[model samples]
Target: MKKLVTLVLFLFILTSTNVVAFANSTPKIPVLLYHVVTQNPSGTYQFSLTDFKNDMAYLKKNGYTPLSLNQYYNILNGTVTAPSRPVLLTFDDSTSDFYTNVYPVLKQYNFKATQFAVTDWLDTNGHLTRAQLQMLSANGIDIANHTIKHQPLTSDWNTQYSAINNANIKLKSITNNAANSVAYPYGNYNSTTMSVLKNLGCQGGFTVSGGLSSSNSNKYELPRIIMANGDSVSVFARKLTTGY
Candidate 1:
């Protein structure tokens, strides 16, 4: 009986050690993608402000740390260590809803986020203006490239290159910060897209593909989970704990 008890204790210790090792080896970072935040959402991509606030509250209460895309890149490159339960919150499209609906909630939590902006859309009606983008950058928000016209990168090489370069230039002019990351327009890209981004010195690229990002993820094709309209608090919890 004494020997049996000793064997069980040894097995428990071994199992616990292996579990810890596995967890350390595989660090899953969930990058959440959001399009627009509004009280009355119009499409599947738009999320209500109420739901967005709830999601933020859950993340804050759950000890999840929000990291900007630049910080995420540093972590991936081993230049920085991540906090426990680190999450990357990314908002695509520089819509006015972000200025009106999202920034206030994020500010309340003192959290940081990345915003991908289309250069041509700025200063237009119902879109984020240059002044707003500059202010967002000053307040810990990273302004990234989302192409000039939000066109799919499956087009010709010149078209793809021009779109990315023009957007980067305009974004830098407005924010005085390098636009080093990109989120593919419509979550769409082709074989030439990555090469174009690389040549332009883009450090990170995001896709709409749903999964947990890791250090081993492709720099130009990093996956992100979409947070859409009507996602409850429970659904948000599951997306963080379990990859889509």
Candidate 2:
């Protein structure tokens, strides 16, 4: 991990884009937020499988390396280094479509990804089953937390804490590992949420806004670029490099 991070720092220095994002005090990572990848898509969160494939292929062709959440944690918390084109592919919601459509393509490219799951939804009708989550966990996909029941975490401390607390327990039970991070449901959170996460010893708390993340970023409020269905391959590429 140290070696990987060192190489990233070397690359980060060589290709530092001062024009993009906040000034480079630390290496910044583009964390992508994706929802369901589907053949027939709907909603602002839905992304077509074809476009998804194109996005993945573009990354491969252009030399982007995707990292799991743990790998990313090591990089950011340790050396603040990054591969020249490093990006974290994060999928919100463990839809069955991820197992059926997405995981295979990610493997084809030998890429790593993190899935933020709503613990209660696992084994439900449309969500990934516990067995499938286990499979994903064992297969290099980092299974993390979305929340207990996809509830809207607000200023209410108990509601926010319970949502995160309950889900971590369920995730640990199913995946054999407690979540190292959590993406607040619907990308909503507050200082109370951060306090709960800190008390729970969570490593990172992801949000929906903010363009990119770095060592200088708030560990409890990292941002991700939301990938919507209407976004084309060009838009996806721009989002990673330019963060607009």
Query: TM-scores across all candidates?
Result: 0.89, 0.87
Where does model 2 exceed 4 Å of error? 1-25
Worst 10 residues of 1 by lDDT: 18-27
Give the worst 10-residue stretch by lDDT in candidate 2.
17-26
**How many residue pairs clash in each candidate at the backbone level?**
0, 1
**Could you give candidate 2's per-residue lDDT for residues 36-85 as a string of tens digits?**
99998998889999999999999999999899787687667644456667
Error of 1 at 92 (Å): 1.0
lDDT of 1 at 222: 94
Candidate 1 backbone collisions, by pair: none
lDDT of 1 by residue, 127-199 (tens): 9999999999999999999999999889889999999999999999999999999899989998799999989
Clashing pairs in 2: 8-82
